[model samples]
Target: MTFFSCRPDTERRKVFHLLSFLFLAGFLLIQSFAAHAALVRIKDIADFEGVRTNQLIGYGLVVGLHGTGDKLTNVLFTRETLISMLNRLGVNIRDREIQLQTHDVAAVMVTADLPPFSHGGGRIDVTVSATGDATDLTGGTLLVTPLMAADGEIYAVAQGSLATNAFSARGAAASIVHNIPTNGHIANGAVVEREVPVDLANRKQMHLSLRNPDFTTAGRIAQAINGSLGSNIARVMDPRTIALDLTLRDSIPALSRIGDLMVEPDTLAKVIVDDASGTIVIGNDVRISTVAIAQGNLTIQVTETPMVSQPGPMSNGTTTVVPRTSINVNNGNNAKLGILRNGPALSDLVSGLNAMGVGPRDMISILQAIKADGALQADLEVR
Candidate 1:
């Protein structure tokens, strides 16, 4: 009778345990939704493979400089090019008779980008940089020059008035310069003479290249594409590329749809340091193992005091100059040991760093040391 009577209590305990599990699962699901990463468009992280910028280069000359042009004596090509240009304009000149000074002219290289879908007779901005010993490019105008592509085919003709962001002034022995005067940019400077041909509508497949390559990100991207459309539409070819098969779907419509889909990209945990600028960039997902960091600043100061030793009160002695210096060092007492626990979130990591009260440059060194000791769980890159 007792054994049969105990069945209700045992069943009640089992039912309570099941209820607890369900409640815990529900809480976890809610937390997962709350902690979701920010959504970004796939177009922001990747681009279509065939859609890219083309580089066009041209050998050109800049005229209308104020005697700051290339010296025609040593830069012989400048004179030769000038003679050829004059001959084209119906003016005859021999090599020996090429003595127009040409000090107001400079040989420069003109460069511009022919963006995808650029057509004939369209204008694009151009950058001109002096190739010779010319000092400044300000107040100069670029001459007509044929811009060529990698295939040695003429793509555009560039000619325009230069607008320089830098300037210079000289007064006999003193001169002040701001920015680089040898290089300048002219907006909408070149006219497109030809077209670079590529058929985008007839492609059976297209590839998406990530700006920042990561395997996890690539997989996530493919999954996002498939989840929005269907299975087998997007496939990962590698860590940096995702191939899209458009044979089954409508080409233009499908591409337009892909751009609208939001995908959460995975970024590698990294710390980038720019020593020249004293800048440090810490990734949001950066982590650290359990470690103790003790850092401090050491400053040394030196002062020079020159003294003159003269003969004192008619005592016969030669006057002399003596150099005196003082040196001092200060080791800051602000240095302290801080223990960091494993698997810190972004806030915790930032809190720990802020507690150290160090500058960006000092933080860069500390991060490098932590990475070397196998404590920092992120890629340390120095620029």
Candidate 2:
């Protein structure tokens, strides 16, 4: 993400000063981390094709609130819905002008993701977000609501007491805010009414994809699959994708064995920088080519004084005012450009940058410059 541009020679002085500040900043960042590192697993970084969850959503109403629900005026649907429910319960209320306790309820949209192959009667967590102008939903219970998918088909039924991380209290003149009001969640609120059709159990072959694309790792995975099953069933199509040949019955076990197989994968080191937040993140594999760096800064100070003098007790002297000004300029110590030779390790590069007395903001820019000049071997991403 970090893009670099050539700095004109005329602006070199200013740019170099800034670069020095950045070098120091980058150095401090590297010093904060421990030297040792943990190796990541190939399965941890990648996903397989057709193995994902589907989103399900439905418009629903949350009832049984403690007098802190959507207003009847803003949520006309709530009033209409309540009326319909009462009629079903053997109560006759034809007039819509009935004074309702809107302060104790809210209307919300419920959503949840259906994992692949989710069966009927299985429960899933649901998220509820108020769709009306309701102020709060504390101690509210969600009524029976049908969760639907984008296809307009009912997939699940959600009903449970909402768990809100936020609460609110209001007075005649003022109010207090604690947490988010518009949204809450209910765990295991939705029971799956339908199932997503997937062939995982009956499929002849299956594929395991890596979260991160790496040709080396993909090949290793194929090897593991073939070795585990004693047959060449798994093959790598690309760094991000793998194809498992299910032509034979034996291929089934080959695919299943892949889950437990271990494959060491190679990864490229990178450095990520966020200019807006002045953040710099360096990966373990980041390497820098040898280069010399020098840094310095200039400081300017200004002061002003205004003085007034009045005529003394006797002589008719006119009053006068005088202004005095003073200015000073201070240049920071000019550090010599230190040489960081090629084959420099991540630690050495950091140490050298720190020695130049750079700041975080400055280091961000310097890293960008170094990466652009091909002196840094790591990928530089800036946000």
Best-fitting candidate, measured by TM-score? 1
Candidate 1 TM-score to native: 0.84
lDDT of 2 at 43: 53
- Tell me the tens digit of each residue's lDDT in model 1 across 1-383: 99999999999999999999999999999888766657788888899888888999999889999999999897988878878888889887964554767689999999999998999999999999999899999999999989999999999999988988999999999999999999999899999999987786788699989999988888988998899888998999888999999888777788878877877888889989999999888898999998888888789999999999998887888999999999998897777897767756878887877776877888888889889999998999999
Candidate of highest lDDT: 1
Per-residue lDDT tens digits for candidate 2, residues 1-383, read 12334445547878898999999988877764433233334456556556689899987778877767788776898777777877888886865457775577787888899998799999999999988887777678888889888888999999999888987878999998898866889999999999878655456656667777888878887787687665677778888887777666554354445565666666778898999989888876777877776656678899998789888898989999988889898786655676766644667667777777788988997888888788888889888
lDDT of candidate model 1 versus the reference: 0.88
Residue 353, candidate 2: C-alpha displacement in angstroms: 3.5
Model 2 regions lying over 4 Å from their true place: 1-43, 75-95, 98-101, 167-179, 250-253, 294-344
lDDT of each: 0.88, 0.77
